[model samples]
Target: MDDINAWVWWLVGAAGLGIPLVVTAMPEFGMLSVGAVAAAVAAGLGGGVVLQVLVFVIVSVALIAVVRPVAARHRTQLPELATGIEALKGKQAIVLERVDGSGAGRVKLGGEIWSARSLDGTQAYEVGQEVDVVDIDGATAIVM
Candidate 1:
């Protein structure tokens, strides 16, 4: 309505922008919401409509240009965390029983007993010997 202040309209616009940001999980909407807030500040300071619009556009464009690439770069980078079987590979295990290529044996790996076999068919690991895990085959660990 004509009676409503321009700053109040800008606040409403910001809230409207916030809805899509929440629902879609898009950062651009959030940047636009911040721009709306900047426009609201301009309105509160008695700036003309063109000045308020200019403030909104400049703030929105700046945020999008700067934040989007940084966010994309972070998203594309891989985390340095390894879990489950992946964490077991290349780890040291103590042979609980004689480990050989011909039969299954037990090894204490990461504080747990795991079925193990030798990586090389002719090689064998004696009890209390330390071995390096090479790979995981189902429930068994291949060690050397």
Candidate 2:
């Protein structure tokens, strides 16, 4: 220990941390590995053991504190894209045929003809009427 340089030890620690990061796929370990690299730089700059340790702790904590929340927010966020059936909901359609709750009709939706029905059981939509699609049930669109 006495013969080896402090920077060498820091580099070795960094490698040790990096191995677990790869295995576990935990970003925290990567942050710690980066901190170890910072400590190695400090050691090469002639920092005392206490200063090297301080640098390591500060860098690691700072990264975890800042990056963790951002990563979590991104993980929990809903995707911007709405595809397939999800994309059809909340869209406007032109009634091609009379649409009423009791019976199925036709509408032009997203440049395609879709089987449609009224959202309310008693309500009816006339031909050429514009209606808002409330939901999709199987191949049919429920509109109002």
Q: Provide the overall lDDT of each model, using Cα atoms, as 2-decimal numbers.
A: 0.96, 0.95
Q: lDDT: which candidate is best?
A: 1
Minimal lDDT window, size 10, model 1 = 97-106
Per-residue CA lDDT of candidate 2, range 38-120, in tens?
99999999999999999999999999999989999999999899999999999999999999996579999999999999989
TM-score for all models, in order of appearance: 0.75, 0.64
Superposed model 2: Cα runs more than 4 Å off: 1-26, 70-88, 100-104, 137-139
Pairs of colliding residues, candidate 1: none
State candidate 1's TM-score: 0.75
Model 1 regions lying over 4 Å from their true place: 81-86, 98-104, 115-126, 134-144
> Residue 138 in candidate 2 has what lDDT?
86
Alpha-carbon lDDT of model 1? 0.96
lDDT of 1 by residue, 34-57 (tens): 999999999999999999999999
